[model samples]
Target: MTDSGAVLPWLVIREDDNGNRYRVGRYATRTEAEQVADRLGARAHERLYVVERVDRATA
Candidate 1:
């Protein structure tokens, strides 16, 4: 859970050099999500990792 004690809504997304994007995972805090992205990015420099809040409107 996040500091605010809410459901995890932040999402980690990976975008490849080929222009493909997909969700990696969800975290309660942005910091946690970023850390995961950083680790993934370090292992695969060819792909790009990013963190974003879940868009309930689109869901």
Candidate 2:
């Protein structure tokens, strides 16, 4: 759960050295790449959004 009181969807965002970007969505697992995708979808561009999950960190 996130601070917003909603189930926090783990997401990712990536930026190429050239400044190109893309978004992949609704993954059952989370990763840095997935979070990058979500961030890109949310902020860098106006497009259809999707939800994904991040891997639970293991201690």
Candidate 3:
């Protein structure tokens, strides 16, 4: 987050079998977020991880 409290553009989200979602982290680029997500996803047995871009206009 910035001083203005703006959220990062890239998000790493984790979802569990129960359909609960959590924000793993935020990044300035999608690639960075995806790398983190992929790393986490590899060790997850029943969970899911995804990377999404947060568009400021729609946010």
lDDT of candidate 1 at residue 16, scale 0 to 100: 95
lDDT of each: 0.88, 0.47, 0.89
- C-alpha-based local distance difference test score of model 3: 0.89
Q: lDDT, candidate 1, residue 37?
A: 95
List, residue by residue over 1-59, the lDDT tens digit for candidate 2: 44555544554434455665444433334564456555665765435344445444620
> Residue 44 error for model 3, in Å?
1.1
Could you tell me how far off, in angstroms, the CA of residue 52 lies in candidate 1 after the best superposition? 0.6
State the TM-score for model 1: 0.80
Which residue pairs come into collision in candidate 1? none
lDDT of 3 by residue, 1-59 (tens): 66779668999999999999998988888888989999999999999999988778865
* Runs off by more than 4 Å, candidate 3: 4-7, 57-59
Sorted by TM-score, highest first, which candidate order results? 3, 1, 2
Per-model TM values vs. the true structure: 0.80, 0.26, 0.81
Off by over 4 Å in 2: 18-52, 56-59
Lowest summed lDDT window (length 10), candidate 1: 1-10
- Sequence-dependent TM-score of model 2: 0.26
